[model samples]
Target: MSSIASFVRGVETLNGWVGKTVAWLALGTVLVCFATVYLRYALNTNFTWLQEAYVWQHATAIVLGGAYTMMTGGFVRVDIFYGKMAPRNRALVDLFGTLLFLFPFMAVVGWAFWRHFWSAAVVGEGSPNPGGLPAWWLLKGTLVIFVALTTLQGLAMIGRSLLVFGGREEFAGTSSH
Candidate 1:
């Protein structure tokens, strides 16, 4: 139980740090997009690299920050059913969901990401568009990162659920969202 508690705390802290770090990419995405628009129209000039830059930033934020979103319970849910359940029942649902649905989904996606990233890295893939960004493999690698972080957060949720079911209220704290 202490080990579970420690795992939960560690995963939460990691996701929290990752969440905070990736959050800044949102601002970067907006700034770069605004600059691209401004430069294209006002300055009568266009740079493909700049155009791709904002797109890359947007993708980076979404891909890398998704685990943080999940950790924070920011994803939409069909709460009409879930919210009506008792706390223990809610924990059970989360536990089953994490095991049956979330873990399997993550595994499949993680496998696919590994294959895709490996292929891209072998070729040193870059943006297909002319004058676009290079080293697209780095962007590809974010898929694996997303899977890993999401898996860690899922494990934390599972630990929290177990704590709830075990009647460890002191450790369970609050239900995840």
Candidate 2:
């Protein structure tokens, strides 16, 4: 039980750190977008790499922050019922949701994205547009990261649910809901 608690804490910590760190990319995306617009409109010039940079940053931030969103309970839910459920019942819902839905979806997406990332890496894929950024494989790899982090968080959720079932809800990590 203690070990399970530790696992939950560890996964949550990792996802929290990753999510917070990647969240900075949102600011970078905005700044880059502003710069791109300024350069294009004010100076009447554009750089493909600059344009693609913001898109990459935006995508990376969103993808990598998924687990964090789950950890913090930021993902949308049909709260009309969920919000009114007892703790144990909520745990049951979370358990089944993770096992029945999240895990399977992650498995399928992970495999598909892994193949895409691998093929891109094998060929050293780059942006197709002239003057666009290089190393498109890096962008594709974010999908793999997304799948991994979300799956790990799902495991943590399962651990939390088990803790609740065992009447050790105190051992559950500080999940938002």
Candidate 3:
């Protein structure tokens, strides 16, 4: 039980740190977008790589930030019913949801894309656009990172649910050990 709690604590801590770190990418995305607009409209300069950079930053931020959002209870839920449920009921709901929906979906998608990321990395795939960003494989690799982190968080949620079911009422929603 202590070990499970410790694992949950570690996962939450990791997701929290990663989420905070990737959040800076939002600022980077905005700045790069502003630069792209300024360069296109004012200077009549267009750089495919620079444009792609903002897009990559945006995608990376969103993808990587997902686990963080989940950890912080930021993901949207049909709370009309959930909000009214008792704590144990909510835990059951979350446990079932994670088991029956989230985990399976992630597993399927991750399996489907496994070869794609592998091929890209193996071949060092690059952007098709001339002068576009290089190492496209790196960008594709974020898919794996996203899935891994989200899966870890999902496991943490499962652990929390188990703890709640085991009578650790304090593990209701938050991922504190």
Candidate 4:
């Protein structure tokens, strides 16, 4: 039980760190987007790389921050149904949802993204648009990162749920919002 608790805590801590780090990309995304728009309209010039830069930053932030969102209970759910349920019941739902939905979905997405990333990496793929960013494989790799982080968080949720089932509700961590 202590080992399970340690695992849960470790995963949550990792996701927290990742989430905090990835959050900086949001600011970068906003700044780059503003620059892109200002350059296009105010300066009467457009750079494809600048345009794609914000998009890439936004995607990276979103993909990398998924586990952090999960840890913080930020994902959408039917709160009307979930909110009314007891803690144990909620844990049951979480366990089933993680097992039945999250795992399988992430597996498929991870597999697909791995293939895409490998292909791009092998070729050193760059943006298709002229003057766009290079190393598109890095962007493609974010999908795999998303899957890994999301899956890790899902496992933590399962461990937390098991704690709840074992009458150790205090270790269950945050409730879904």
TM-score of each: 0.93, 0.96, 0.96, 0.94
Give each model's whole-structure lDDT: 0.85, 0.92, 0.90, 0.91
Give the Å error, residue 160, model 4. 0.2
lDDT of 2: 0.92
Query: Order of candidates by TM-score, top first?
Result: 2, 3, 4, 1
Q: Write the per-residue lDDT of candidate 1 for residues 32-76, one digit (tens) a residue.
A: 999989998999889999988888888888988888788777889
Give Cα distance to truth, residue 60, candidate 2, Å: 0.4
**CA deviation > 4 Å runs, candidate 4:** 173-177
On residues 67-155, what C-alpha lDDT tens digit does candidate 2 reach at each position? 99999889887899888888888899999999999999999999999999999999999999999999999999999999999999999
Candidate 3 residue pairs in clash (backbone atoms < 3 Å): none
Q: Write one digit per residue (lDDT tens) for candidate 3, span 83-165.
A: 89888998899899999999999999788667778999999999999999999989888988999999999999999888888
Scored against the true structure, residue 82 in model 1 reaches a CA lDDT of: 84
What lDDT is reached at residue 166 by model 1?
84
Clashing pairs in 1: none
Candidate 4, 13-127: lDDT as tens digits: 8889889998999999999999999998899999999999999999999999988998888888779988888889989998999999999999999999999999999999999
Off by over 4 Å in 2: 171-177
| Top TM-score hit | 2
What are the clashing pairs of model 2?
none
